[model samples]
Target: MLTAPGSLKAECSNCGATHTPLWRRGLNDKLNCNACGLYCKLHKCLRPKSMRASHGEGRRSGASSLASALSALASVAAPPPSSATPVVEVVSPGVSSAQCYNCHTTATPLWRKDEEGKTVCNACSLYYKLHGSARPISMKSDIIRKRSRHDARAQRSSLTEPPSASNTPGTPSETPSASPGVSRRPRPV
Candidate 1:
């Protein structure tokens, strides 16, 4: 049902994307697809064509079915062990399967102790520390957000890089223009 305007019939100048939710301008005012434009804006370079996805293609593919079939065939073709031994797992005394005191969730990336020395999940502990109160149960979510961490070396190199003439200290371009849907916060001194 979604259709592009007649003027947008041309493919993206960078990634050659024929379809995009939104069109954006890139270097030299060239027409770039949404993904390419965002990538270029963040990295200050054109997006690599290798990262482009085929239209209507998905992450799941025939290769996964072939891999499953091969695994099943291998399991059937292999002989059973001559002697089967019972496997036992030993848990250390210091480690306990404790649930978070606040959220009551058993799973967490890290566990921390509350003011009363009760086990609490990382999120609950951090929230309580920042807000000085227990995190609302209504705010709990099943999905965990993955964050991309920058390498220390890359961070150091960027910090050391000389500022361009347009973005030099005290220049009008020193402060970045606010992008739509993104909030700008002043850095702590």
Candidate 2:
């Protein structure tokens, strides 16, 4: 709330000192105490009786303006909103964005949506199957076989890779060996 000049007498909330408004003419605008030497800030001061009434009137005027604006808005026809309430989009499980809640593994080729709406890997699903926790209504035998083959190939490749320098000490430096009956040496041009 604001007031006309000389209408408000500000009292400090902290020190209980009453002060008249001091309008700084040049570089500063502050109200300083004649008694306690305290500075009174404009926003910190509570609204005076006249100031409150003036602010109340201003608020009423603003409300009337807003009401008039809303009525003006009602005159124009607008297309119906697609949905009254904003639809919260839910991401489907086993999509690229979906991660396993248990293992934090990014699902590849997507997984079947379990009853609890979770994306579970084949291994986890098999475990559940073994435990008789739940059975899938339909099974894809081809996918299961493909997944097994892929896993086996991955395991083999990992095993074939040479141990890192940190893992093996005093081991001879090794490069790729030629295949059986194949020579790596350069042939005559």
Candidate 3:
């Protein structure tokens, strides 16, 4: 598939052009056949060839080969981008790297494998903990962050305050005021 420098002549299947690509340089230069003006690109199949021929240019096999070759290159090249849509990773279990199944995120620290073996991230896990169910995918991160912060504050309060003074449901003395402008329950100080 490769040859010494200046010795990479390949006959284009589409254009029938004899091309000598600088294979070492990995250039996919576009070239036209001198006899018929059939265009070819030489990259992997040598000149990224376009299988879609011009009117009366060439057979469909050449065009199909070009299209297939380009698609194969695309599939090989697209993975490194990490932001491409429809990303499919073949991650093995027990590997340090893992994707969160719930949010499809790869932040490992934020993810945990739940009892059902699905990966759930921090916010999703907390949602499950609080609701005894999976968090809806439509749940906004901002709201979840706010709730997480509130939960953290409550945890701190519970550690420092007496059980009776904690304004829990059993404590009528610490109940929030029933004033018109006041909210039903005051947020923890």
Q: Rank the candidates by lDDT, best first.
A: 1, 3, 2
Give a tens-digit lDDT track for model 3, residues 1-189: 222334455443344534323222222443333222222223234333343334423333576747765775676573554555655677687655665667655553466668897877787777788999877877734433334787899899899976665656644454557675566645899
lDDT of 1 by residue, 1-189 (tens): 122356736577876666677778888888877768887899888976445544422122558645654664665574754568534466698665678889888767889999899999888999999999999999887777665566767888899998677765554554556785454545589
| Model 1 stretches with alpha carbons more than 4 Å out | 1-96, 150-189
What shift in Å separates residue 96 of candidate 3 from its native position after superposition? 7.7
Q: In what order do the candidates fall by TM-score, top score first? A: 1, 3, 2
| Candidate 2: residue pairs that collide | none
Candidate 3 weakest ten by summed lDDT: 34-43
Query: Which candidate's lDDT is highest?
Result: 1
State the C-alpha lDDT per candidate. 0.71, 0.46, 0.52
For model 2, the stretches where C-alpha displacement exceeds 4 angstroms are 1-95, 133-189
Query: What number of clashing residue pairs does each candidate have, in the order they appear?
Result: 0, 0, 8
Output the better candidate (1/3) by lDDT.
1
> Residue 177 in candidate 2 has what lDDT?
59
Candidate 3 overall Cα lDDT vs. reference?
0.52
